[model samples]
Target: LIITIFYSTDNPLNKSAITVPQRAVSTFDQQDLSINMHILKWKVTLEMIKDKPLFGSGIGTFKINYLDYQADFLQKNPGYIKYSGKAAEAHNEYLQMLAELGIPGFLVFLSIIFVFYSLALKYLKNKHNNQNRLIVFGLLMGITCFLIHCLFTFPFHVPVLGSTFFIFLGLSVVYIGGFGLSKVDTKKNIRIKLNLNYLIKKIIIILMFIVGIFLIYTLVFKPYFAEIHYFKGIKYYEKGNYNDALKDFKHAVWLAPYNGRILHALGSTYYHLDIQDEAQETLQRTKYYFNDRNIFRNLGLSYKQSGNYQEAEKEFKQAIYLDPNFTKAYIDLAYLYATQEDYDKAIIEWNKILEIEPNFSEKYNVLYFIGLTYQKKQMPDKALEYFLEALQLTPEGSPIIEEIEKEIYNIYKDRLNK
Candidate 1:
C-alpha cells in the first residue's frame, strides 16, 4: 500500500518529480524537517528526564509538560517553529519511559520483557511436544516484534493495543507454566464461599478497578480527545474557517484546561477571527502558563491589530529578548516602526534582524523593506544601494525581481527628474 501510494500518478514521488533536483531538494527538506522534529521531541524528553530523573515526569505527563519543554527548545532553535504547532509524544518509547516513569519504572518494564523471553525459552526447550514448542517459538517471536515496535513507536501507550499485549503476556505465562484442563485437580482447587471478609475484599478490588478506570478516562481519554479536536481546529484554521476552528479549539481547551498549547492555538485562532481583545486575553493567559517567544509574538500581533502600537512594540521586544534568533519578532518590530514613520529606528531594527539571522529565508524581503525605509527617510543613495542588492538576491524568474526592478527604476527616475 505504501509503495502504491508513493508511485501513484498524482503523488510527488512520481518518477518525473524525483528527477528534478530542485523539487527533490524541497521534498527532501520537508521530510528532513519532519525527522528533525522527532529529534527535537527527544531533546524535550531529555529535559523531562532532567526535571524528574527519579520516577519520571509521571505517566501521561509527556503531553502535559511537552509544551514547556518545546518552548525552551524553540527559543534556542527558532527555525524549529515551522514544524512546531501541537506538542508531540516522545517517538522513542524507551526514552519516553525514562522521562515519564524514571529509572526504576524503566527497569521494571525491561524486567517484564526479559522474564517473558526467559519463559519462552524455557518452554521452547521442552520439545517433548513439537506443537507446544512451535507455539512458544511463535509467542517469543511475537513478543520480540512487539518490543522492537515499542522502541520506535508508542505501542504501549495505546490503551487497546497495550491491553491486548498484556492479555497475550498472561496467556504466554500460563502456557509456559504448562497449565491444562486435564491436570486441574478439582479436589485441591477449593473455591471459597462469599463470606463477609471475602465480600469486603471483592468490593475493595471492584472499587480499585473503578478508580483506575476513572483516572485513565480523565487523564488519558480526555486529553487524547482534546488533542484530536485541537488538530481538527488546526485544519479548519488552515482552511480559513475561523469560526469552526475557534469552536473546535474552545472545545479542546474545555476538555484539557491545563493544556498550554491548546490555549495558544485558541488565542491564535481568536486573533485570526479579528477578536483582538479576546486574542490578547487568551494569549496573555497562555504566556502565564508557558514562556514561549511565539506566544509573545502572537500577543504582539494581537496588540498591533488592536492599534496599540506601544504595547505591541513592548511584546515584540520581549519576544526578541527571549529568543534573539526570532526573526519574526524583529520583522514585526521593524514593520511596527515603519508603520509609525519611525524610519531611522525601523532601519536599525531591520539591520539587527540581518545581524541576528544573516541567512534568513526572507532575507531579500528584509533588504527590500529596508530600502523602502531608507527611501521614506529621503536617503535615495542608501535606498538604491539596498534595492539593487535585493534585486540581485531575488530569484531570476521571480515576480519579486520585477517589483525590485520597478523600485530601482522609480528611484532613478525621481533623481533624474530632480
Candidate 2:
C-alpha cells in the first residue's frame, strides 16, 4: 500500500472526471458501458427458469423463446431496455442449461460433471496410477480448458469444440483406468439363441426402418424445400422487392401451409403492399400458428391503416406485451397515438423509446418526435428542450441538423414576440 501510494497521484478528482456529458453520448448509449447486455440476458434467463422450473422451455428453445421473456422483464424494468437484444446465447453455459433444461435437467447435468471430477480427482491422486498420471493430466487439462471457456461462452454449441472437449474427457477416463474404462464378461455375453422369433424380429426391424425413413422425409426433407423458398422470399423482402417477396412467400406457404414464420412474412408483405384486408387476413392466420411479436406488430399496422384505431391499439399492446424491448413496436404505437392528436400520450410513448434506445440509434428520432408533439400541445419551452437535445445528438453535415436548428430558431423567435 505504501509503495502504491508513493507512485500514484495525490490530486483529487474534479466534476469533469466524475460526470460524463450527455451531449456526445446519451444516457441510452452509456447504459451499456460494459457487459450489461450479458447481465440483462442472465436476468431474463432467470425469469425463464421461474416460468418453467421443472421441464424448462425445452432443449435448444432458448434462442427461439428468450426474446419474449426479455421483453416482459424490460416492460417492468424500463431502464434495462437499452441493454436488450436477440442474444443467441446466455453468455453463461451453466445458466443457459438451467434455463433451457429446467431444474431436473440442470441437476442431472451437474451430477454428471460432479461425478466425472470426483472420479478424476480420485484417479489423479492414486499413487499406483503414477505411470499414466501424465497422460491423464494432459487430457484433463484439455477438458478443463473447454470448461473454463464455457464460463463466458457456449463452447458446447460449437461442434468441433464440444467434440474435442468430450474426446479429452474420454481419453482422461481411459488413461485414468489403465486396465480399461469398461469391462465385459465374454463368457456371459457370447451366448446366442436362434428361433422362429428371430425371423419375426428381422421383419419388424425392416418395417420400422422404412417407416422411420418416411417420417424423416415428411418432416425434415419436406420442410427443407420450404426453407429454400422462405430464404428466397427473405432476400427479396430485404431488397424492397415486395412483389418478388410475395411470390416466393406464396410458394413457401403453398409448400408449408402451417409454417407460421413464412405466413408472418407473407402477411407483412401484404401490409406493405397496402392490401390491408389480405394483410389482416394472413396475419390472423399466422396468429393461430405462430407466437412471434413481429406478427402482432404487423397486424397492428394493417389495422391502423384501415382506420381501426381501437383494434390497432390492442394489437400494438399485444405486440409490446410479447416483446417490449422491440423498439419499433413502441415507435409505431406512439405514431398511432400522434395520428389521433393525443399529444401527451404520444410523447409518453415516444419517451419510452428513449428509455430503451438500442445503441442510441433512435435517440434523434425519439427526441425530434417528442419535440414536435410538445409543439402541438402549445408547450414551446418543452419542445425547445427536446429539439436542442436532438440537435446535440445530430451528426455534422446532416440535413436533419438544419431542420432541428430551424425548429429551435422558430421557438426562440415566437418567445421573443410574446
Highest TM-score scorer: 2
Candidate 1 at residue 408, lDDT? 90
As a whole number from 0 to 100, the lDDT of residue 357 in candidate 2 is: 62
Model 1 TM-score?
0.65
TM-score of each: 0.65, 0.70
Q: lDDT of each structure?
A: 0.82, 0.82
Deviation (Å) of 341 in candidate 2? 3.0
- Compared with the true structure, what per-residue lDDT tens digits does model 2 show for residues 1-418? 5543433433353323322333234424535444678778889988988899888987777876777788789888987865667776898888899888999998997887787787777767766555576766666666777788787678888889878777777666666665444445666877666655878989989999999999998888878888999999999999999999999999989878988889999999999999999999999998766667888899999999999999999999888876666788899999999999988788888877777664567588689889999999999999999999899888788788888998999999998898
Task: Kindly list the per-residue Cα lDDT of model 1 for residues 129-211, writing each as its tens digit.
Answer: 77777777787778778878776578877889889889889888887776432246667998977567778889989999999
Over 4 Å off in model 1, which ranges? 1-44, 63-87, 125-128, 157-164, 178-187, 190-262, 286-296, 307-330, 337-364, 376-378, 389-410, 413-418
User: Would you list the clashing residue pairs of candidate 1?
Assistant: 55-101, 55-102
Model 2: what TM-score? 0.70
